[model samples]
Target: MSMFGAVDLSSFAPKQGSTPAEPAAGAAHNGRPGGLVVDVDAQNLREIAEGSARVPVVVVMHSSRAQASVDLVDLLERLVVEYAGSFQLARVDVDAAPEVAQALQVTAVPTVVALIAGQPVPMFQGSAPEEQLRALLDQLLEVAARNGVDGRLDLDAAAHMAEPTEPEETEVERQAREAIERGDWTAAEKVYEHAIAQSPADDDLKAARDQIRMLARMDGQDPVALLAAADAPGADLDTQLAGADAALAQGDVNACLGRALEAVRAHTGEERERARLRLLELFTIIGTTAPEVARARRQLATILY
Candidate 1:
């Protein structure tokens, strides 16, 4: 079933074999204050569209005359900075680039579109709540990754975020990291498990243990297909649990917890207990300090009582 509801967008795909335009001279790849935000016009539309071949480009079609559009663009600019080059933001002033807007069949201001591999995907129109937009972006990344558009923008070259000093890994953590690099997931999981068992009160070790377990479960698996299977009518508990793992595998912690939470909400007796335990596993994966984990914990507490 198409999510866009009869709005055919296939025509928006870039023409086949159209050579991608090169970046301008002296471009520092997000050399502006708005991070990866770039102004798009008739002249640059092809450039921006073609650039999607490398990384997903989020096109924000807006009008300067509208305060809502202005506010949305500002919010998107901040979001681009926060995302650390997950995607490039192409700001198209519909007034200035009327031809571009008309070509894309935009009837309103503040239309948001995602271009992945030169295929235009309709996202939303008008402004959205920050949390909602964040969720959408996560979903977008997951979809893009499944379609083999897993390229990431060079965050090191981004101007928005300041570089941070990386902490030296402890010996045990280093061993576990090496094991993971070697595809010895079981060994990596065991290393963390042994460390956590020795230092029962060490929260960091416990978190690392959970992370290792998550990576082990997600190894070389299609998390998207797992999610789709779980969403199938009358899906079993095992499939639902696997879907939760898939969500975490793709970096959507909310969806990971959400799948288990939904199972808990829909089941009772032994099934609900299993679902509850699964949610607890995800909580451990993210840790208590994570905002999403905290919120999910609250939701879980509310559901239980």
Candidate 2:
């Protein structure tokens, strides 16, 4: 079994009537390993071989005409970026490079091969997730290290593989947005949470999530109900705070401000602090245009003085 489901050997061998040829410049799977991508054709044949000779290269061959193949290519690109610091990714259009395709014995529209030292080794065809691909890469690296090629290529592989994974992040964000657009608030929330969990420190994901949160607040909840519940006469600090939080969650900035101020007026230090922090978050969400932001800055200066 391969990292992606079960491995199918049908895609490994060359197609019928295809003859194996000696590795040549611009030849499918022919370029020298242990170096940067040099031959355009060869480079194209192997998705990523240069700078990753010791790490093994995953050549993703796809037909541009096939929708599934095209999608697989895009996913592969995302995986390349995600594992940029670990492996090299190169693409060969089977339709464009027919001989190379024939040489690789590709019978399918999308085939992915792991090549080490200029030889095709374990391969998986079809679309595989990034996690699965990474797993295979880890296994390949371990095997290579055991084979004595890791030490010489470790640094080079690391350097060659470090590409931005933001594209993947963006794709995730887009899917979340689409979910929200489809009125699937729970699904959207889950996706957004996943994105945040995966990258808690990511400012972009954080910002995008803030937008989603705002949208979620406007969906079914009634802002007035929350505010009234929080402000009912003689409400305890905790109850009021919960109500204020609900208001904030419903995108009711004014209600949050009023409830927070009421809590402060009652001499509730803890509630005051919570409201203050929530105010800061509100400003962050609403951006810098709020007059309260400037007032807050001046008040900070006065307090420091």
Candidate 3:
């Protein structure tokens, strides 16, 4: 089952071959001080959710027909400005993106949900006092930190000034960048993997490989399906491994490592050794410096001796 529940959001995905409706004039801030607010629809919902991999995105679903919902939107906008880009606010007009709202199972107007690493964490429905909302937001930030989603948008830039362009890239870097842009994660990974193999000592290549691996893991499979398969009674080691990868992809580092550790404790002899090796491989993917990796290492040691 999904951490969020039995909701299958794939059904709500924008239909293929249909053009995405453009945002209304003034609905999006091109570049403003604390540019953390954006109007979202079914077409852009996936992109906004994916952005949670970098920073927590608070999605507010509301209907323009309701005055209360409009008031809630105004309040959220003010809060986003006050928060100074600590988190982004994605406003979803229910009338415009009913599919998106239905996917989230919104029973009423002005439902708030937080997306952390592409997974939804339901916040609340309807409006609350500013003080209570701030407390809830504070808690959300804490959750974001624990999941390694602690990133902030640049809030100090002036809206009137033109945004700076990125520097040009090398041939290989350009290839990888384009592949990533096109959502060809495997192709991008191959590029980085080959570069790392050619120059094993290049820390930059190694870092790039790790980052792509994480992205590939996230984009590789559906977390809910993987979890269900792993939970099956007759699930083999391979199934368990895939589930662990899915968890890691969803930014549940602890769940990923904990599942592997459970395997280590459950199996023995050759099977145990295989689990141990797989856990070590995951450690490398997560990086040696991560607190989750460190904690898993200690747990592994305890399980061994």
- Give one clash count per candidate, in the order shown: 0, 8, 0
Q: Which candidate, 1 or 3, has the higher lDDT?
A: 1
Q: Give the TM-score (vs. native) of candidate 2.
A: 0.36
| Among all candidates shown, the one with the greatest lDDT | 1
Decoy 3 TM-score against native: 0.46
Alpha-carbon local distance difference test for all models: 0.73, 0.54, 0.72
lDDT of 1 by residue, 90-144 (tens): 8887645666877786766678888876777888886688888888788777666
Over 4 Å off in model 1, which ranges?
1-164
Error of 2 at 66 (Å): 1.5
Residues forming the 10-long window of minimal summed lDDT in candidate 1: 1-10
CA RMSD of all predictions:
15.3, 20.1, 16.6
lDDT (C-alpha) at residue 57 in model 1: 82
State, as a TM-score between 0 and 1, how close model 1 is to the true structure: 0.48
